[model samples]
Target: MTRPPAENQELYRFSTAERWVHRTSSTLMMVAIVTAAFLYLPMLAELVGRRRLLVTVHEWAGIALPAPLLAGIFFRSLRADLRRLNRFGPQDKGWAWRAMRYGTRAAGAAGKFNAGQKLYAALIAGATLVMMGTGLLMWFPHLSSLTWRTGATFVHDWLALLVGVLVIGHVRMAMKDPEARHGMRTGRVSPAWARREHRLWAEEEAEKQAEAESAEG
Candidate 1:
């Protein structure tokens, strides 16, 4: 494989563990979505004719959806990313307004992850937790009241649809930026790319590098 050239000035964007976690979560989420479709879509359900198997797989997949992210908590880099995702400062709020108004061109001096990315991360994390809880309730009706189970099922179905839509949008956005995808895949991005897309993060990274070099000297 011809390796992509990352110049010396390229910045480290994601750690190997962070990439692994992202891939793992993505794969498992896809599995859960497919199995959910198989179990719920009447025509597809009839075609598949394996309700028991699909149900078991869907339940297990839902339970495992957060495993990769939970495991990532052990890594300092992942923890740092989590913290970044949780934060929404004044810059992030301003960026969000501009992004909504002007699209990608308005992605102002965002940090490692932009306000949109941060919001997506937070929404997906919350959705995952909600899905897990509702899935367990649906999987074991005996654990909850009929009313609660009914509500859980309704919430699970609707949330699954919402998540699917969000994931589609997220993928579409990723497709628009090959360098962004490359960063996720390889854990590095060109400094020029970073500066153009995430100027604040690029500046912070440069400062950190300068400090490290000074200490070494």
Candidate 2:
């Protein structure tokens, strides 16, 4: 028998807490980005005056953002994501090459998470560290040398640029599949959805279930 959308199918790849954390962090980061661009970008500077307000918003937003990520550490989904995102096997390399070619289309041959997604996760992880570090240097520029401070600024700016590109890719990937978004929305995926996108995970779950059944019987 097939499970209905409302059934407890154990089809959720990301737990509720994980979704909450990601959603909170992503939303605030976007807000900060929009506010910062208006205040700091050369073209938009005139329109969004008062740099002080922009800075305050960015500062508080940053303060609010890390809380979710930290909280997510306790969630199993994040641990799985960390492993899945960083595990670059031979198949991942091939998947990534194919994804670059067929980005706007469905991957003709694909794995659970594509190469681009894995690479994007790595980029985000690295960019996140640099972005935080550079922000700290800027926040306390007097402690560093003039040259060091200038370098930090360049690093910070470049990291932002790369993060912007990745965000575009992230959005496109999500938009290409409505089920992906639905998973986020309701914290549930149809069982068929899980099996299609993450067969290995589904298999693991099945094995676990079989073990549990045998022990129970």
Please provide, for model 2 over 169-214, each residue's C-alpha lDDT reduced to its tens digit, 9 standing for 90 to 100: 7887799889889988777676676666655555555666667667
User: RMSD of candidate 1 to the true fold?
Assistant: 4.4
lDDT of 1: 0.86
Considering summed lDDT, which 10 consecutive residues are worst modelled in model 1? 1-10
TM-score each candidate.
0.92, 0.83
What TM-score number comes out for model 1?
Answer: 0.92
Candidate 2 ranges with C-alpha deviation above 4 Å: 1-10, 103-112, 213-217
Q: What pairs collide in candidate 1?
A: none
Q: Pick the candidate with the highest TM-score.
A: 1
Look at candidate 2 and tell me the lDDT of residue 25.
Answer: 78
